[model samples]
Target: MKLLLKNTRTLTENGEFEACDVLIVENMVQTISSFIEIEDVDRIIDCQERLLVPGFIDVHIHLREPGGEHKETIKTGTKAAARGGFTTVCAMPNTNPVPDKLETVQQLLERIKNDALVRVLPYAAITKGLKGEELTNIDQLSKLDIFGFTDDGVGIQAADAMYRAMQLAAQNGKAIVAHCEDNSIVYGGVVHDGAVSKRLDLPGIPSLSESVQIARDVLLAEATGCHYHVCHVSTKESVRVIRDAKKAGIKVTAEVTPHHLLLSEDAIEQDDANFKMNPPLRSKEDQDALLEGLLEGTIDFIATDHAPHSSDEKAQGMLHAPFGIVGLETAFPLLYTYLVKQNKITLKQLVDWLTIKPASIFGLPYGKLAANVVADLTLIDVEREMNIDKHTFYSKGKNTPFHNWNVTGVPVLTICDGEIVYEEDFHV
Candidate 1:
């Protein structure tokens, strides 16, 4: 099929343009020129004044399928990813039946191939059943075309286990993504263990719960010679740790969720469990540090950590509720509206964080609009303004704290592997 997208601002690695025509043939970009004279084009998307970008990629998302289909399945989660302008997403294997075995990873691949709206790359669990005890079959699992390995909902508390896992993963040429939480220090607490938790008389989850583990992993990774990635870094101390690790020349990378970068524990005072998440949002100082890290390029990319739990699960009070918020559907609009428009970050930097940076970190063949690259693209109607509406969400979960928040940009069309997976104006 031949697709022509014209009158759009194409976002290149260098910068943005006023207008260009993106020509696609099948699953590759045939040409991106000022004008194209082509015959027998199957479709033409008039992206006048809109921003055409390489479809965003999320390296951290929990599909919760092959287990918690009630919360989110491959179909629902990937639809959410597509609607959020993501052409590719990596699913962390902390599912009911952990995807540590090669057979489990293969099953997930099949499920995603049949059900997902966008590409879903599975991340096998670093340990079988994610028990953090025995290591998963890295040799076999790595051969299945998976991306990275992570016992993601929890840090492999055993240093020996983690070191061994990283060594094996490094030898296999795979990266080790760590949850970076010291569950031992977390002590089963709920919110950030500070003013908000004290005032509400709730159990507190301390900042060190994350930072301590990040510190430990950095050292271990240095010794193991593996590419270590810190997931959803939320504290100032964690930022310093990652920064120092990078300085020390460790093969390290880290990501910050939009919630942690934009929101703080102050929002928790409003009594909404939706604000709740694992490594719960921290203090204003922590938020500032996270933003500083992003501005200075210390943080590698922005991942939604797009954890989706059902309303029923989230409805369970703050203390007993599941820890996460639905982010994939709202990430772009929120970031573009807040960070880009405010000039805290440039559009090019923002796109790179969402696209190229992530691809680089995970070593995927995505995040570029150049010729012969996979034709995964996201067309954004930058001029469009809208409010966050859970009703329009494609995922089964609607536990986002940003409900009703005003957002200016939205994805108008999403194309994956040359297929028009999602389009706002579907009928036309």
Candidate 2:
């Protein structure tokens, strides 16, 4: 089917918005110009002067399938991604039977082929069963259609194990996406080790717990020449280390979550599990550093880290509740409202962080809105303001801290590969 998106302001290469129309014909962007003669088009969408940009790409998300479908599935998770303006998302390997072997990776591919509404790229495990004891067959897994390797939920604890994994990843020409945390320093903490934890009398997770591991990995990556990507960075020290690594010409990249950028440990309220997450929200100083890193290009991009858990698991409160909160549905709106509207960053920069930057890091072909590129696009109503209600989310997880927050810039239409996967009812 041929689809034409009209009356929209599209983002340009020069970081300016230009009025143009996009034409998609059966999976690729056929044309993008000021005016295209409409003929034989199956559908024409009136965008009403809204913004049309490349679809968002999230490099970190947990589609709890193959084992934790009760929390989320490929179908539901992709639907949530579509509603959030993301056309592609990399699924973490922390599923029931981890995608450590070829068979497990194949299983995930089959499920994504059958169930995903948007594109789903699976990451193979860095360690066997993600136990950090044995390295997986990176050479064999790299041959499969997988997106690098990572043990997302758990950090690789042993330096020798991590060094070996980096060596293997370097040999295979693949990245080792790391969840940097030193277990020895964690000490059963649930929140950031700062004034909030002290005042609340809660176990504190020290900032060094995250930065120490990042510091070690930076050296290993420098030594082995591996493309090391840090996951969900939350500390000021980690940002500084990453900056220095890049200055020293190390092949290192990092991503910051919306929560880490927007909130801090001071936002945590008593007994609210929604505020809990791994590498827990750091102090205000750390948050400021993360923002600066993003603006200065030390942070590569923004990812949702869209983890989901059962309601009962989250209802256990701060002490016992699992770390994570659903992010896919709120990432864009929250960022646009808080960052762009507050003059912290330009709209183009925000869009690039969600689009081209991630695509460049992952070497994917779905982040540009040009001819011959895949028709992965999103139209957002930047003027619309709506309260965030988790009940309205497509994913089963209703564990977000942004509840009742009024935010602008809601996604109204998402088209993936020439198909209209999600469209909001503007009449409502």
Candidate 3:
């Protein structure tokens, strides 16, 4: 089938919007020109001047499947990713019967093939059962076209174990994606160690809990020559350590979540569990450093860390509730509103971080837009502001703090491999 996107406004190499039409034949882009005849098209959509770009890519997201289906699944999670303009999301391995061995990874690949609406690159576990004690067969699982290795929900607590994992991953030519947290330093803390935790009468999780682990791992990566990618970096100290590592020429890269960039501890009002997440929102100083790090190229890109939890579980309040909130459905709009509209980052910069930079980091081939490229594209309504209604979300987890917040740059249509994965009736 042929699809023609008409009257599209797309960014050019000069970072200016140019009016054009893109012709997609089956799963590939056939042409992108100022004017294209549309007689042979099976479907046509008038973009009406909305911005068109390569579909977004998220490097870190939790799609609870194989065990935690009550919270989320591959089907619901990928559908939510499509709604948010994401075409590819790397699924973290924190599931029941974790992807620690060949059979588990094979089973996950089969499930993704049957249920996923968007592309999901599954990460194999770094430690078997994610116990942070024994290493999984990294050499064996890496051959299954796995995304990488990670124990996302919990950090690898043992330095010797991490060192061995990094050596094996490096030998297999794969990245060791880390969830940087020292459980010993966490000290049963639920929120950032700052004024907010004190005001809420909650235990504080210190910045060192994240940074100290990162400092150790970067050095390990230096010795092992492994691609060390940090996930959901939330503290100023972590930023400084990463910046120094990058300057020292260590093979280190890092991602910041949308919430860490958009909200600080001050944004937390009361003991709402929706505000609770791992490596909890830090002080305004930490938040400002995160933005600066991104602008200065110290941070590589943004990821959702799109963790979802059941409502009953979240209602347990800040201390007892699970650590996480849904992000895939709200990442782009929220970032566009608070960061781009506020003149902190340009729209083009935001799009690059969400698209090409992430794909480049992970060596994925789907984040470019051109003739002959895969038809993984998305259209966004940059002018029309809409309130986020959790009821309208395709995700089972509506645990976002941005609900009811008015924002622009909402995704209107998303296409993956020439198929319409998500579309709205009309742009408002």
> What TM-score, over all chains together, does every model reach?
0.98, 0.99, 0.99
Candidate 2 at 152: error in angstroms?
0.8
Counting clashing residue pairs in each candidate, in order, gives 0, 0, 0
- Regions of candidate 1 where Cα sits further than 4 Å from its true position: 12-14, 426-428
Could you report the Cα RMSD, in angstroms, for every candidate shown?
1.4, 1.0, 0.9
Query: In model 1, which residue pairs have backbone atoms overlapping below 3 Å?
Result: none
How would you encode candidate 1's per-residue C-alpha lDDT over 15-132 as one tens digit per residue?
7565688889999999988887778799887876688889999999989998899989999999899999999999989897788887778888899889999998889989888889
Candidate 1, position 162, lDDT: 92
Residue-wise C-alpha lDDT for candidate 3, range 1-428, written one tens digit per residue:
99999989988777789999999999999999999996878999989988999999998998999899999999999999999999999999999999999999999999999999999999999999999988999889989978999999899999999999999999998999999999998989999999988898899999999999999999999999999999988888899999999999999999999999999999998999999999899999999999999999999999999999999999999989999989998999999999999999988899999999999888888888899999999999898789999888888998988889999888999999889999998634
Give the range of the ten consecutive residues with the poorest summed lDDT in model 1: 11-20
Residue 371 of model 2, lDDT score:
91
Instruction: For candidate 2, write residues 1-428 as lDDT tens digits.
Output: 89988888987778787998888999999899898778799988878889998899999999999899989999999999999999999999999899999999998999999999999989999998899999999999999989899999888899999999999999988999999999999999999988988888999999999999999999999999999999999999999999999999999999999999999988986869999999799999999999999989999999999999999999998899999999998999999999999999989999999999999987888788889899999999999999999999899899999999999999999998888889998745
Worst 10 residues of 3 by lDDT: 419-428
Give Cα-based local distance difference scores for all models: 0.88, 0.93, 0.93
